[model samples]
Target: MKTPSAFYKPLAIGAPEPFREIPVSLERMIHFVPPHIEKMRAKVPDLIEKVDVVLGNLEDAIPADAKSDARNGFIQMARDNDFGSTGLWTRVNCLNSPWFLDDIVEIVGAVGEKLDVVMLPKVEGPWDIHYLDQLLAQLEAKDGLSKPILIHAILETAEGVKNVEQIAAASPRMHGMSLGPADLAASRGMKTTRVGGGHPDYAVLSDADDGGARAAYQQDLWHYTVGKMVDACLSYGIKPFYGPFGDFSDPAACESQFRNAFLMGCLGAWSLHPTQIGIAKKVFSPDAGEVEFARKILEAMPDGTGAVMIDGKMQDDATWKQAKVIFDLAKLVASKDADMAVIYGF
Candidate 1:
C-alpha cells in the first residue's frame, strides 16, 4: 500500500499526530443527523451525549438545491459546539457530484481542524481514496491546518465491493469503511425496493414431502458483503462498520442485524433515528452474561497457553482470543460509564 507522493505526510517536530485511530468500542454507534435541518442542528448537542459519533450528513439527507446550505451549516455547527471524544464527522456528496469539491474546500478550509472523519459516498475503488487523500492534503496545506483530516469510504458500488481490500489500504489517512446497502442494491440491479432491510419475499425453502409445508429459511441479504468487509478492514488495521438499517419501527430486527455485524467483527453501525441509537449501543456492547462467561474462560486459562475445560466447555487458544475480544471491549466501555465500570470490575 504505497502512499501517493502528493498526499499529505505529517511533519514531525512540534504538533500532535495528524490522525486518530478510533477505538472499536468508542465507535459502536454513529448517529446520522442532517446538517441542513435547523431542527436537527438544534437537537445535535443533546444527541452528542447519547451517540458515539454524530455525523453531520451533508449528502443524501440534504436536497439538491440545499447542498450549499448543508455545506455552510456543517461549518457553523462544527465551530459553534464541541464534540469532545464523541467524534464529529461529515458526509460529503459523491465523488462525481458537483457539490463534492466545494464541500471539501469550504468546510476543510474553514473548520477542518474540528472534523474527525470526512466520509465520501459511492467510493468505487482505491482511486477514489487516492484522489480524496491528495485533495485533503492540498486543502490542509493551503488552510494552514495543524492536523490532517481522515477519510472514510462508503462501499456502495459493485466496483467498490470488488476492490474493497484495496480501498481499505488506499490512504494513509483512511480511518474506516462503511457498507452502504441501498446504493449497493441499485448498483447490482437487486430487486429489493427497501433501503437496507431484508425482504420477506426473498428466502430459501425446502421441498415439500407428503403434502406437508416446506420449511422456509430466512436469510440476511447483507451477510456476505459485511463479512468480507470486516476481513478487509482487519487486514489493514482500520475499522469496519455496518451502514444504516432504515426500519426504525422494528427495534428487534435492528438489534438482530447489529448483533450479526458485531459477531462478524464490525465495530459499529449507523443510527438513522433516535430510537436506533440505544439499540445499536446495546447490541454492540458485550452482553453481561457473555462477559462473565468470557472472564471464566480467561481465568481458567491463566497461562494463556494450550487447552482447558471451563464449565464443561473446551477452552483453547481460539477461545482465549474470543474471550479477550469481549473483555477488552468491556474494559474500554467501562472507562466511559460509571455503571459499566462497576459491572466490568465485578
Candidate 2:
C-alpha cells in the first residue's frame, strides 16, 4: 500500500529539533490552570514546583464571556512569574471560535518568548496545525520574538485522530499531541457522558446462560485511538500525552488510566486537578526497582550488541535496547531532583 501523501513531507517554515547530549522531555504530569480564576494563578508558584508543566487555559475551561480576561490573564501570569524548569503552556480557543484569533495574536505577541508551548484544541487535520504554524511565524517576526513558539495539537476529533500521522509530522514546530477524550467522545457520538474514563455500559459482560453471575468488564474507550496516536508521535520523534481524567476522587481509576497510557508508550498524561498530579507523575516515572534491574542488565552487558547470561536468564540485544531506555530516563530524572539523584545512585 502506498504511504499517506502527508508522510515524509514536513510543513514549511519549521526546522527539525536538534539533538542534545542529554535529551530532556517532560513525560510526567501536566497541570492545568484556568487563567480566568484568580485562585488558579495564585497557585502557580506552588504548582510550578510540583508539576513538570503548568498550562494556563484560555479555551473550553474558560467561559465565552471571560475569554478575553483569560487570555490577558494567561499572558500576564507568564510575564509575572518565572517558570524555571516547569514549562508554561497555554491551551488556546479552538480555531473556529471568535476568541481564537485574538488568542493567537495577543498571547504570542506578548508572552510568546516566555511561553514554552501553545496548545491548539479541536484540531481537525494538518491544516489546522499549518494555520497555527504560519500565524506563529508571522507573529514571531512582527513581535521580534527571539524564539518561535511550539505547537501542541490536541487530538479530540474523529478527523484529527484519523489524520494524526499527518498532524504529528506537519511541522518541526510541532511539540507533541494530547488525547482529548471528552471532545473526541462528542465527535464520535459516543453514549457516555463521563470525561475520559471507562463507562460501565461501554464494557464487556459475562454470558447469561452459562455463567452463575454476570460481570461487567470495563475497557478503555480510547485504547485504539491512543495506540495509533503513540505510534504516530514516536514515528515523528515527537511526544504523545494522555489528556485529563475527570474522576478525580477515584484515585485508583485515575492511576489505572495513567498506567495504561504509560505502558502503551505515552510520554505522560495530563492532570486536571492537583489531586491527580501525584498519580500522573508516579505512573509516568520509571519504577525504582525496574530501573535498578535495567542498570544491572546494562552493567552485565557492557557490550550492547551481544547476548549474555545474567541470574539464569538470557539477555540479548533486544533487552539491552529496552534497558537503555530506562537508564536514560533514570539519569534524566535524577538530574532534576536531588532525591531521585540519590535513588538512582548518581
Q: How much is the lDDT of residue 287 in candidate 2?
A: 89
Clashes of each: 0, 0
Pairs in clash, predicted candidate 1: none
lDDT of 2 by residue, 1-346 (tens): 1155543233333423222211355648888898988887898989878888989988887778999999888987898899888888999889998988999889877888888788999988888987887777777777667665788899999999889999987776778999999999999999878888788777888789765788889888989999999999989888899998988789998898889988898878888888898888788878888898899899988889888887788999999999998888888777666677787787
All candidates: TM-score: 0.93, 0.91
Please identify model 2 stretches exceeding 4 Å from their true place.
1-23, 206-211
Go through the candidates in order and give the C-alpha RMSD of each one to the true structure. 2.6, 3.5
Q: What C-alpha root-mean-square deviation, in Å, does candidate 2 show against the real structure?
A: 3.5
Give model 1's TM-score versus the native structure. Answer: 0.93
Top-scoring candidate (TM-score): 1
C-alpha lDDT score of every prediction, in listed order: 0.84, 0.83
Q: Which ten-residue region of model 1 has the weakest summed lDDT?
A: 6-15
